[model samples]
Target: MKAENLAKILKNYTSGWVSISKNYKKVIASGRTLRVLLQKLEKMGNPDGYLMRAAKDYSGYVGV
Candidate 1:
């Protein structure tokens, strides 16, 4: 996935609450708030893809 595409997904959310697939093609996780979004990511392992959004909103995914 391209950084540009990830940016596009993030724009939709002003807050840091979204997770995209490794290819940045699909949204694997998303939340209206940062906390919820993070919980989702935590449940998931470090996916091949990457995450985008404000640093304050996301700190990266944690593994189970």
Candidate 2:
């Protein structure tokens, strides 16, 4: 998926760790931390995904 499009989807998330589906077509789960997110995924049978964080303020935000 395009970065621009992904950004649009992520904008809907105010805070938390977001798990993007393997196909990048949808959000698998979201939680306040990796452990929480992983637990949620475990309940869902642990589908593959990528992790990303959502901020309260995106402006001027920098991630390594």
Candidate 1 residue-wise lDDT at 62: 39
lDDT (Cα, tens digit) per residue for candidate 1, span 1-64: 2223344555556665567775556777777676777777788874555554533332353322
Per-residue alpha-carbon lDDT of candidate 2 for residues 6-57, written as tens digits (9 for 90 to 100): 6655767878798887666788899998889989999999989888887767
lDDT of 1: 0.58
Question: How many clashes in each structure?
Answer: 1, 0
In terms of TM-score, which candidate is strongest? 2
lDDT of each: 0.58, 0.77
lDDT of 2 at 35: 87
TM-score of each: 0.47, 0.71
Best by lDDT: 2
Clash-forming residue pairs, model 1 = 22-49
lDDT of 2 at 2: 37
